[model samples]
Structures are given as structure tokens and as C-alpha cells.
Target chain A: MSQNVEPFKGLKKLNRKLAKLHHILKRDINISTVSTPTNNLVLCNSGLVNGLTEDQVFEHFSKHGEISNITMLPGKSCCFVSFSKKDSATSAYECFNGKLNISQNNRPVYLSFVEEVPKPSIEVIWNELPPGLLVFKNFISTEEELNLLKLIDFNHEQCGLLKHRLVKHFGFEFRYDINNVDKNQPLDQSVPTETDFLWLKLAQIQPEFKGFKPDQLTVNHYAPGQGIPHHIDTHSAFEDPIICLSLGSSIVMEFKKDGTHTCVLLPQRSLLVMSGESRYDWTHGIVPRKFDIIKTKLGGYTCLKRTTRVSFTFRKVLSTGKCECFYRSKCDSFLNCNIEEKMAVQLEKMHVHKVYDNIANHFSNTRHKPWPNVMDFVQSFDSGDFLVDVGCGNGKYLSNNTHTFEIGCDRSANLIEICRNRKFEAFLTDCLSIPIRDNCIDGVISIAVIHHLANESRRLQAIQEIVRILKKGGKALIYVWAHEQVKNKQKSSYIMQDRKNRKGTKEMNGQCLTSAQQVSLDSGNITLPVHSNRSNFQADDLLVPWKLKGDEEENESVFLRFYHVFKEHELEELCLKVENVRILKSYYDQGNWCVLFQKM
Target chain B: MKLLTHNVLTSKCIRGVTVGYPLLIKATNVKVSEVEFKPDFVAKVLPKIEWDVLANAAESLGHWQNLPKELPNNYENDTDFLKKIHRVLLEVEVIQGELICPESGRKFPITNGIANMLLNEDEV
Candidate 1:
């Protein structure tokens, strides 16, 4: 099959429209363009440019030689540059919304370099590159310093290399001890030594990581044929770049690039920063293999033997003190109660993952803007109805006026301001403490907010808040994540650590640290949730975190055992339990379990 | 109204518990109305529907039994199968009775043909 046939259609159409749009937009507005008559600089002819649509422009760009990188701004034009050689770095000199301008038909095309563009300057410190972008020389020392030749069980010895990568990329250090290594063990059982934590501390020393920290560092040990499946890192609790440091073995980190395979070998001691495409766009996994002859060994040595490999994947979570949504009771009726067994199980999984993924997707997508669902919802409501939006991330729904009188509350202030600026009444409040008086609002809506909150007390508190704010007979449209919604054939849920005597479920082990614990911890090269309003929970547990207090029991946090799945019977039961709350309608919204209730 | 819901609905959760839950309808029991096709809506619902369960339910009901075993990307015309699907999933309303759970085997009967799922504490 021709690669261009099905895949590039959208891009093709986009290019054509863009070309036409550029011409029209140029005529419609005065843009500052700089022109120099150079034969090497190929500018489209006026008539051709005028008549050209977006598709033609794309075709033109496609035909105009090999395009290395193409990016479109939020404006009418897009900029792409072609390199003369493979590794030759050529800057566009601040094109589009920058100082760089192009003269077309005796008119300068307007581009702004005043804002949102990197300032052009010669290098002082090569480290001066932006936080996400940096290059360091001598990142790793020679093999003698590495002392690899003198070690047994090369996997444990290789922790030094992994530490080297962490310091180079994430500005962290690690430590490992041979005694801690469980040699000749299963993939998940092998443990990282003190060097791992030492590298973590090195990463912490970086000024950029200040205040942002890591609570969990999942050490995944891989042998041949052992691999992780297609899945997202559970960052709903934290917004950070998952830093992965590879050691001992060479494995291909298979990344999905626009649905195509883009395999990159993670060589020994090589630090691969996975974010953006690697994080959001593609899933990463290593195919189980004993021998990887593809990668060259460190210090001109021949290929090394594969014993076992360890990866230290670290992240920082932005805590939401109280989970906005949660299932109050497990559907225990399944064993004893009567229901469609298959349907019940399927539905239960659907609800669990549905809520989980939806909430995650919503936050992931809207982290930079307002929630997109608010726009669709506001169009249905009238102005007079007092609307209460629960878990309103930065008030995207409230900002746009469908109804004039609306109260949007969220845990994150950064998100609230985004909504508040849009014209909706936004507040930084928890779902439980709903700032509004009881029986005040006409309608209440919570979308994709409940699943992140896996605590029962918090979920109950939020429901009560929603009930208290709404007027008698007011409508409540609440959406929950369904189970098994996240499907990537490659997911592997290996036990991280099994602490048998732990108070909580086996799933959490003893790793259940409060978001507050995340503070003052070392995050390996991961971004913090500064822009998110949900990170407030990282600071406190009783007030913003909304958990129980004052007793030894308060010190213990609940670890998720079984997924808090909802059965049809359980849903009906819940509807009955919430006094004066009647079920209005229930349906699936984009693979989620949505229930419409009314305060009667 | 969809046959997919029908396959899952049984008179088993509670006495009248299945009432509104499965909210029953007679074979020749309800009204079928025609609405303009919305491809977007159909696409949205496609992933949510259980194909096997829907097909079995359609076959048992004897409506649109000729539907292709797999879900087609696009349907050109409103075939008997399509109509049946549309009718059962969207239009047919249970004017009365409870929907029972196939696994739990409890009776949730419908009153006024409306299934009421409310149960006492002992049952909960």
C-alpha cells in the first residue's frame, strides 16, 4: 500500500488550505516580512501562491525537497525548513511571530519575534539551552573510571553507567550495592542497589527540580522476552516526565510514531528522556531478547553478554488532596446477587477504566487550556439556572457563557484562572467543601473528574457536596470512568514490591505515599504540576487533601485493592442511598458511565 | 430500546428491581418510530455495543436477523437489520416491568411497566 494514500490525506488537505489561507491572511492583515533577493531562497510565485490551497502548499513543500521539520502556529501560516545535509543545524531566524519576515509581491509578510520566541544569542554556557533541551560533553567517563571489567554479574555493576546517564540528562545521581542485587532471579525480583538512590539524589541537585519531586521510582528489571505493554504512565496523580535510565543490557524502546514503529535502542548507561511524543503520542516497550548485537559497547569493546537489565523510571505527582470521584462500594452483589454475569463483568471493567482514562485524557489534553467538554455542555443550559460544575479544571466550561450565572470550582487555581478569565465564575474549592450554600444551584455537572479520586470518604464527600449545593429537583449529570477502557495489548502489571504485612491491599504494597510525601523528594528530570490547579493536594492532607486526621489510623493511606467497579445493581443501590437524590438518566458518554440524577 | 440492552435485561435483580432497569416491552409491545440517520452518533455508540450480545438478541427477537456478524464501517441503506438495530436500541421504550439479571437470577419486576430498582436494607 502507498504510504501517502491513507495516512497523509489530512496533512495534504491541511497544506492546501494553509497555502490559500496564507495568501488571504496576508491580504487581510499587515504583517512585517523581510525579503532578500537570493536565488537559494525559493519563494512561491504570487499567482501560484494566491491560487494555491492548503493541499497544494503541502504538495509544494513535499516537492520542494526533503522537509526535516514542519510545524504550524495557531495563526494562518506554517513554517518548515529543509536542511542541506543530515546533521547540519540551520535556524529559521525567528520566523512567524518573530523578527524574521518574508517579502511577497512588494509586501512584507508580518511575523512577530517580540514574544513567545527564543531570543537569538551566541552561546555562553552550552547548558544555557532551555530546561527541556540540554547537551553535556564528557557526560560519561572512560571505562577505567567505570571499573566494569572488575565486576561480577555485569547487571549490578552496570548501575554506575545508568547513574552516569541520570546525571548527564536529569541532573541526578544514583547508588547501587552488590549485596542488594538478587542475581539469577526473575525479571521483577532483581533490585537496584544504593547507586540507584544516589543517582536519584544527583537528579535532585538540579535547580530546575527544586520543589518538584519524585515519590515513586519503579525499577523494572527485564530479561529476554520480558517487555512492558502499550500503556500510559499513571501520571494522573503527578504531572512529570517519566525519566528512564537504562543499564546492563541493550534493548530497543519501541515507540509508536504516528502509528508507525520508530525503534530506538536504549544502550547501556544511556538515558532516554521520554516525553511529548514518547510520552503522550507513543507507547514504549522492550521486546524480550537475550542478545542485542545492534548497539556498540562502551569504550570500543565488543558486544557484552546479557545477564539482566534494570531501568529506574522515576516521576513526580501533583497531588489532589481529595480524589474528586470514587466508587463508594465494590459490587459485592456479583457473587451472591443476580445479574448478567458477562455483561456485569464487562460493564464493571468498562466503568472503571472509562472513568480513569477519561479523566486522565481530559486533564492531559486540557492541561494547557480549558476543558473542551464545557463548551458542548453550556450550549444546552439556560442562563438563569445556577450551575455547579464539580472538579472544574480551570473552569473551561464556566468561562464560555451558555448560562451567565455559573459557579466553577476546581482544586487547581491555575486552572480556575483560565476559566475565570473566560467569563464563568470559577473557584478553587474541593468537591466536598463546595463553597455554595445548600439548595442554591439549579444544576450540577461533573465530567471525567471522579475517577482520579479513589478514596471512598472523598467520593462520598463530593457527592454530598453536589447534593447540598443543588436546589430541590435540580439535575446532576455526573460522569465516571469505566473499567478496562485503557487497551494496549502490551500492558504488564508486575508487582513492584510485595510487602506481605502491609495494612492495605497487595496492589499498593507499602509504596502508598501521600502527595505531601512527594514534596521534598527527588524527581528524576520530571516536570512538576505548577500549571495545574490539582497540585494543591501535594501540600496538605487534612484541608486541601481532605483525608481523615488526628489518629494513628489517619497516618495510613488506602491502597487500591480491587477496582472500585460499579454494577447496575450497585448503581441503583447508590441512587437509593443518596437521600432525595433520584436517578434521572444513565448512559455511556464516550465510553464512560454517566448518570443523571436529580435532587428530589 | 436497542437489542443490545434487551439481551442483557432480565427480570432477575429484584422484585420490580428490574422494572426500570430492564423496563420491559412486549414483542409486538411498543412503538417504532423513524428518525433521520446520524452517522456520528452511530459511530460513537458502535464501540460501546457488545456485538455478540446484540446479534443474539436481534436473532432471538427475529428482527434484522440477517445483519452481518461484524460491525460494518458504514451502512449505505436502512436494511431490515439496520432498522431493527435502530428500532431496538433507540426507539423501543419499555412502557412497563423489571429487567432481571442473567447471572444473579434475581427478579426485579416492573410496576406500571416501569422497572424500580429500589431495594430494602436486607436485600442490599
Candidate 2:
């Protein structure tokens, strides 16, 4: 008793700074002001959003006295912990208030007395799972689980490398870069025969799986501190009723949508089944940590140390490679998929198309010289060959390839005016849907245009449109800005050009200094990196500044243009997503990733 | 925009508009100019042409010169008809016009010989 009594002496120091503590709590999450000392204490900077679990709070505060309840606020950075007696609460306040960092990457915990805690139906919320979610216990015996684990060769390296966890796939390899599978390229090996018991047991339990035949398997090995990112499996890539069998250790997976979330406990040897709404709408993933907070035998939460966990995810590759789910808002491949566009399209209109139109004259003046390899590609075509130049700006390459008949198209109105003035036939059209008839063109060239697209689906759609117009054996040349500026100790021309002009003019785009903007997609809203215009890249998605020699009043007016620079080999990877196209050549040019593909 | 492009430009990229081909030409100002006729190029790609749509567009623009309503047999071997086909496909241009989608009835404006097929951002 005396050992714990001495810690309360620090309470005198905390009382002097009570006013600053009150502002912090009131400013962040809306909670009542600090009152006289009581049994309830609202601890700031120590909540689930700060990576503090309920068990961590219970273990830390219970040292002072008995814990009545610990409430973890959803999507908040504060929690309310109560004690049985006021003395115990005061001891915890004195011991930790403004004295210790609650988490490894945050400020010290700020404790203040409150009269009562916000009472939510805690037990009911945790007990119920999302709609169309099911769990079966003891689906496979321990001996069978061990034998199945042995079948996984850790030395195998077929699956694409992911930074978060170890993964292996059979039957058909899953492509994480596109978040889909190559339906035409199935592996020679199929799902193992040893895991037949797991499927048979699942089928016996659920009537919907009576005739289910899973054709693909992805085995994941996760260490204690590793986790997969939150995502829903691509709807167009797989069929319904995806199932996963947990073999090694138990963990808590979070299912979240909108602002609500539910933590699900998948114990060892249990099988989790997701279908319908749960499989199509809700996103699921584990929080990377060393321990998980879960309910103990006595109905009190306790810290469960995590261990190596392995799971086998079984899915049936959709034969038609499309999902016609009734949830039209959430479905990607629904029938008549002419829905509202994504934020990518909206962003392209504002940052890319508008910017080009505004700066068409200056841009055309600066971009008169065409790259040699691109010129070579155009000259290779025979005299009678006809080609369409998608995203052709100012017709810099149109007259150079006079041997071949070519018509240009772009998304800018001002730039197309310049093309018209130059007597080059051009039109206003989006690259995603070219107006040309199918299999009619001999070649296509898209230079520094694909990077302006904000998302992968749009980029792939653009490539597919190009391939749709090319005749058999017709070639296409594509180029995009590369993120790797200095390759093999040699600085690229893009980076070297900027080095000489680093004075007086300051970048006006300060989007990166603020929080990320919420870009609303069809399924839901996601935070994308804000537009930045710094010399060094803060992220893959950024904005580069184009300063104008401005009016007499203002010295300079800077415009920020958005660009999504590609990583090394990213262009080849995107080209592989298109069917019946062979990537003939993929190389790094002066500062861009270039690819030449031919229709097969 | 050339008659060749008008033959194939579709408003189907718009939501709920399935068949946007043969966009009805509503030209306020039409222009005619001579383009270098390349017989070999026109001969190689004659079959891909939708002759009916091209004829209809030419008729609407008042540039139709007794062109057949249907694709003629052995048109690739007929050099005289191929020159006429080349003139109608490349020489006739809709300088200032609006392309009306047959299904959606949405109009895409044409200014200075360039047809704007970009969907409105709000519509998208």
C-alpha cells in the first residue's frame, strides 16, 4: 500500500497546468470540461486511433486500483476510463497525467476528471458481426492444419512481392498492383488436394456451398507486427462467398465502412465466411501490432500477445470476369455500367485539362521539339499507313511523320486551336474512349499524357481504348514521367533542368502542407495525397508548378498541374493488363518510362 | 470535323446512351477544302467505312454528290468512285456545328473544324 501511495505526490505539479489541458481536450474531440476529482477520468491522446488498445489502458490503470470499464471511442483519439473509487482515479491522474507518453508516437497522456463516462452498448456492438458474415469453429483438425502448413513451400517465390506480408498463390496468381487476377494466364499448378477437408466441412455447414468449387488459393504468412492493408477483394475478379481458414494464431480483424467499424475475432482453427454485402461492400484488414485486445473468459478485456499466423484464402475466379451484384452502387462490373464518374475524372478536368487550356500558348511554345525515339517510331510506318495520335498537343509530331497519314486528338480546346491553325487535322476527345472504329489504325502514340490520369482504372481504360483501335500487328508508343530521377548516379534531364531555376520564384501550391483531400469514389470516400509542388517528391501523386511571366502588378503567377509519376517498370506493368497486346519494348528514356506494344 | 470522323463518333460514352453512332450533324457554317487524295490509303481501308452513315452525314451537310446509299460492290477496284469517296471523307468539313446524339439527344459542339466529344464534367 505504501509503494502506490508515494506516486500521488506528483499531483501538485499537474494542477498548475490545468488550463492548457482543458483547451487540448476541448479542441480535439468534443468532451465536457474537467470537473472536480471524481471516479471517471477522460484520458486525452490515448485512444484506439492513437494505436492504444483497451487492454493497454486496463493494464496501465489497473495498477492503481480496480477498473470499472474502459470505453474506446470509435474514430477518436480519446478514451474514458473509470475506477470504483475516487481515490483510485486520483492516483492514476497523479501518476500519469502529463507525465508519460501513452503511445510510442504521441505526446504524453492528459488526464482530467469527469463526472460520468459516455455509456454505449459495448457488449452488443462487439457481439454482432457485419451482415452476411459467418464463423465456424473447429473447421479442421490440428493435425490436418499442420500437414497443410507443411505443403506450403516457404522457398517458393511465384507470388508478386508485397512489402507487408508473405504471400503465395496457386491455380492463378493474384496481381496486387492492379488488385485483380489475369484470367487468361492460369498457373500450371492448382490448389492443393490436402486442403479438401476444409472445403468439404464448409460445404456441409453452409447450404450455399453445396456445389461451390474454388479455383484459386492465396496463402498468407503474417508475422506478429505485420498486417495487410484494408481493402475489399475486387468484385469483378472473384465470385461470391469468399472463405478463409485461420491455422496458426488468433487475431482481430476490423471490418469498416463509412464511420463505423467492428472488430472480429478469428480464433485458430476457425473458418470465416464472407458473402453478399459483407464480401462486396465492407473492407477488412488487421491492425499491425504486437498484441490484440480481446474478451477473456471472465468477459473482461485482456491483452493477447500475437504470434505467427497463416491463413489460406479460397476463392472461385469468376468465369465471365464480371460481377452483377444487386448492389449497384458498390458493384464495379454491374450491367450497363454507365454510372457517375470518379473523383479522378473531376480532378483531371480541374488540374490537367483546365491547366493545359489556360497555358496552351506558352506550353506549345516550350514543347516544339519532339523526342528522337518518338519521331523514329512515327517514321517507321510505311508511306500509306494511317495513324491516330491520341492526346496530341500542338501537333509537334504530326508534320514530322508526313510519310504516314495521321489525325490528332486531345482533351484541350486551346491546344486543338493551335493544331487547327497549323493545318494539322485534329479533334477534341478523351483518350479513355477514342472515336475511331475498331482495328482500323496502323499505329498510336501517347506522349506524356497517361501520367495526367489520376487513377489506375482510368490509365488502363485509356490503354484499352488505344488497343481497341489498332489493327493486327499495329504498334503503339506510350510515355509517362518516371519517378526515378537519378538512375545509376546520372541525374535525369527533368531533375537537372530544375536545378538551374531555383531562385526568387516560390512554389505557390501548398496542398501538401495541409491534410489529404477526401476523393469520393463510387464505393466510398478515400483520402488522396494533396497536390504538392516542391522540388523533392513527397509522394507519387503531386503537382508541378508552371510559372507565368505575369502582369505588371504581380511579379509572377504560378499554376500547379497535377501529375501521377510512374515508378520503374510501372508502364510495362500497366500495359500487361490489356489483353491481346504484346509489350515489344519497355525502356527508360531521358526522363520518362516508355513502352512500345503491338496488337497480337 | 471530317465526315469520316462524323461517321464513327459516338455519344455512347455518355451514360445511358447505348448507340451514339451517326451523330446528326447540325452545322452552322460548313467549309470545303481540297485534301491530297491518297488512293492506296483509301483503297486499303474501304471495307471499314460505314458508307450509309457517311452518305447520310454528307446529305445533311448539303455536300452529297449522288453518292450511293449502299456500299458499292468492288469499290476498292473502282478508282473513280474511290476519289469521290476520298473527297466526301476528307474534303468536306463541319467548321461550326453541333453533333446531336441520336439516343440521348445531347449535342456536342463543333468549333473551327474540331468536334468536341468530351463529356461534360457534370454529366460524367
Candidate number of the best TM-score: 2
lDDT of 1 at A113: 17
DockQ for each of the predicted structures, in order? 0.01, 0.30
Score each candidate by Cα lDDT: 0.41, 0.77
Docking outcome class, model 2: acceptable
Candidate 2 ranges beyond 4 A from true positions: A1-11, A17-41, A44-53, A62-68, A74-78, A83-115, A119-124, A153-161, A296-299, A334-336, A339-356, A362-392, A401-413, A416-600, B1-124
User: What TM-score number comes out for model 2?
Assistant: 0.60
TM-score of chain B of each: 0.57, 0.92
Q: Model 2, residue B48: displacement in angstroms?
A: 18
For model 1, what share of native contacts is present?
Answer: 0.00
- What tens digits encode model 1's per-residue C-alpha lDDT throughout A148-189? 223224344333233112211111221121101111122332
**Tens-digit per-residue lDDT, A104-175, candidate 2:** 464567788987677543432454689999988787788987998888866665544456678889899886
> Among all windows of ten consecutive residues in candidate 2 chain A, which has the lowest summed lDDT?
A504-513
C-alpha TM-scores of all predictions: 0.26, 0.60
lDDT of 1 at A164: 18
